[model samples]
Target chain A: MSILINKDTRVICQGITGKVGMFHTKGCLEYGTQMVGGVTPGKGGTTVEGLPVFDTVAEAVEQTGCDATMIFVPPAFTADAILEAVDAGLKTVIAITEGVPALDMVYVYEVVKRTGVNLVGPNCPGVITPEECKIGIMPGYIHKKGPVGVMSRSGTLTYEAVWQLSNLGLGQSTCVGLGGDPIVGTSFIDLFKMYQADDDTEAILMMGEIGGTAEEEAAAFVKQHVTKPVAAFIAGRTAPPGKRMGHAGAIISGGKGTATEKVAALEDAGIEVANGPADMGAALQRAMKRGR
Target chain B: MKVHEYQAKQILRDAGVAVPEGIVAKTPADAAAAFDKLGGSIAVVKAQIHAGGRGKGTLKEHPDQRGVQLVRSREEAEQVAARLIGNTLVTIQTGPEGKVVNQVLVEAGCNIARELYLGIVLDRSAAKPVVMASSEGGVEIEKVAEETPELIFKEHFTPDRGLDDFQVRKLCSKLNLAGASVSSAMRFMKGLCRVYSELDCSMAEINPLVVTADGELMALDAKISFDDNAIFRHPQLKELRDRTEEDPYELRAGDAGLSYVKLEGNIGCLVNGAGLAMSTMDLIKLHGGEPANFLDVGGGANVQQVTEAFRILLDDKNVKAVLVNIFGGIMRCTTIANALLEAYKSVGFNVPLVVRLEGTEVEQGRKIIADSDVDIITAEGLTDAAKKVVAAATGATA
Candidate 1:
């Protein structure tokens, strides 16, 4: 009943020969993900971790019938790898590589839309359906299969929220990292729809940051459409204006994208807002009670 | 990845966009020579900094002196440049501490018949590059958007197609441009759009897109910022970065592949992930303590980056305590623990330190810290970490 991915979803790794790619591929495999094969351009016809390697995504798909892909290509070539996966009819493409050019993402966003493909991230930890499957760099032990669905714009922060929830005896249906970049493949609204439709997901937890109106837009959408209880924690409240706090996309610029404004928007939409990082679990508890 | 006005004008001019000719001068003598070379009776000397609102900004030492001033003679240009260069400028954008103006741009004055506002930015909601124009110029665009929203006309264009001719024409008509000015506006706007896309600009703004007496459209002021993620493709744009305009600690952190921003607080925070770093700052503030800086060691941060991050955090004189919060994902908790031990031995932490490690290999990481002889306070959770760090920073018993 988990959204986006589960045990039956066979996946391939792009750029699986690289150090980071290989390390996380093994991590995903150890998490019991259906790691079928890998693609490394020139390094085809090889074997790694007892899995076959192919030259292109198409070949990998043909040989293994993989329906999903985890991309670990470098930033410069991440867009091409994503397009290759989409062109090969991979239903779900997850890009874990960071620093992909904004223009490249802009073009990729349009193509992904035209082709009806679900793209997860270019600077994110990827996705996980608790014990069923894991397709990202997030720590696998912190998650437990349950009713809550989590989505966030950060990696470690997502882990923080999940840890709090799991410690509070609330396991997750799925956790999706939407990435920290200014331009990404997925948005909060897109994931909200899936979480609302998933039978296993009784509640939703959203983690957002300063910069951009995505949270505000998501708040508006949730108010109009979502029936599931939702709680959110927006970071960067203590951030000064015009200063980029770590993330490239996280900044208050031209009097816009302030945390104050985002918090006000989320609260106005009837979503429970966490007071701080430690309050995420409590806020979700309050949201679920209110939904009942 | 923001370029100075002079640098932005140079980039725009090279991209076939019409901009006022300007020369960057680091000294009064260079400014005087530039004024003389321009051969104009009236020239503008502008303080070159990364912030905007420079035209209305005032010098801290000489409140009567403006950052941007019109000079009648070469000596006047030199005098204005002398007052601006090496002086702190306090603008609406720059904080009260002000930014040190290291250079001045001396440019020939423009004959402005009319002024308009033009800006190109990636519209996050629309998921496309948008060109915004307004007849109200030489003022803050935010003010216009807030006060008279309809005055701003926006046109969204895809990256591959760029700004279409019809979009430009529609904007010109909306701006009340007619006759030869319409065609000039078309060329100016289209060329600017081309430069915006080709250069991977995050924002390209002309506060006052001036229409001359001869019906020629020119960019009187240019403020361009390229996408930092896209800067790798444009090697030439990388050279345009002004290190003097940035904080030394932040620059050092960037060199070490850490994302850091210096803030005016006492508690230094070193954490993983941007969101977690910011949330750590918020928690510190919530616990009645202020964070000195925001430093994200980043996912998969190795021993070197962690050690460097510690050095940068400890280097801040305002820091009274340091907090390390790591929720390991791709980055393991043991790696952070080992790095912390390495940093404790190499950099030597003088400030009271608090560490919170969670996620993968937590026990091993905690064991590493416990086994080490370094003095450290360990917390179990995020709330405990924040309260302990705040108490430690305030010199109170926790």
Candidate 2:
């Protein structure tokens, strides 16, 4: 009962000829994700790791009947790749590429909103449905199929949380990395809604960092819409202001998007916020028990 | 990615935006020559540093020297420049260890009828670029937004199409601009918006968009930052990067395709992804330890890059212990382990090291590390790793 993907979700690869695309496509295939075909603009009619490659996304979708596409194109072409996927009528697109310009993402958001297609990340670690399907670049060994759904704005941090939860025997239903970019296609609100609707997701473990008002808005959405128990963790509590902190979106500009503000907002919504990354597993455990 | 005020003004000027006539001077003689060339009785000599509040900043060595000073004569301009150049100027933005002033902008002073703030910033909530205007111009816009939010007005604009007529009109009316000043403001804003979109700038701020007593709109001060990701599309913009403004280690790390930040701790960290790097730092602090730096080798870093990352961490003088946390996803743990051993062989492991690895081929990764002759401590989990590193760093038992 994964929110976005399962074993049956057929996936096509965008920029499947690239080095990263080749490596992760093989990984995804090994994890049991249905690799239908791939799209490389000029390198159509080729094969990568035994998967057929088409010139355009439309052709790949037509020939393979794939419903989803995972993008590993470089930054310069990522926006266009997303637009191509949306234009071709792909229902879900997961972009693992990092460093797509913020302005480009602004336009992508406008287009995706109008088309009503779900887009995961341009600088994220993709999404995983544990054991059933994995589209992102997360370690598959640690993730186990379970009732707790996890979401984060970071790549390795998501792995850390998921690993802790799995070690605690509280595996995740689906884990989504929302990308650590200033502009992202999906927010915590978007995932919270999906997790709430998914019957298998008994509790939600949300990990956020100081950045945009996405966390605040998600808190508002959870208060109004999500009835499922949710545990939250916000990183960069000890980080200084104005530093980029590795992620382009991790800066606290104009005194906004501080860790304290996000923690306060989440607590205001009756969600338990963890003290640190290590405490999140226990926090989710408490939230799940309360929900039961 | 932040360009100096003079450089930002040059960009805005090239984009047809009206900016103050100025010349960059590196020395006192150059300042005097620039003042003479401008042929103004009064000129403003401003220090060129990548920070705000320069007008109020004072030199660290000379208490009487201000970063920005008004000079009535060419000699005064030379004197101000002499006091500023080769001296550290401390501003509110720059910490106590202020940036050294290598250059100064000498410009003909303007007769200001009124001071107004104008800026174009990428608004994440709206998912668009917004033009922000406030009557309280010269002061800090952040303070104004915090104390009197209503004083500031914003108009969101699409990047491809740029500022719409309606948005420009709304901006003018909201700022109580009318008549010739209205057209002047409109032209200035349109040009600024063009610069923002065409150059792919994340933020373009004009702290004091001045209206001269003669009814002309001019950008008195400009601070612009380009999107690092989009810098490839605009190759010319990359030339504006001032390596002097950034930490040497961070700049080198960037060149090596690693994200690194030096901190005031003794425990060096190498991890994958930004979030995990930060979490590792936080955990190190939680366990009574301070992290010397934050280094993310990224998701696709190869063995060579990992070795370089190790070299970078070891380069930090304060590093007494090092922690390498890798959660292999697309990056293999075995690859990282091989790189770590190779880096140790080349750089020499002079510090206590702790490693916690998980994910693909992790068993093989652990076995390689175990088989290696490098003195390394492996942890079972993040918490245990933190404790081990902290204990090693502080000379306490694990």
For candidate 1, list the clashing residue pairs, or say none.
none
Q: List model 2 lDDT by residue over A262-289, tens digit each.
A: 9999998879888787898989988878
TM-score of each: 0.98, 0.97
Q: What's the CA error at residue B183 for candidate 2, in Å? A: 0.4
What TM-score, to 2 decimals, does candidate 1 have? 0.98
- State how far residue B333 of model 2 sits from its true place (Å): 1.0
Q: Positional deviation of B44 in candidate 1, in angstroms? A: 1.3
The lDDT for every candidate, in the order shown, is 0.91, 0.89
The runs of at least 3 residues in candidate 2 whose Cα sits more than 4 Å from the true structure, single-residue gaps closed, are B396-398
Stretches of candidate 1 off by over 4 Å are B396-398
Error of 2 at A216 (Å): 1.4
Model 2 residue pairs with clashes: B117-B137
Q: Interface RMSD of every candidate? A: 1.1, 1.2
How far out, in Å, is residue B190 in model 1?
0.9
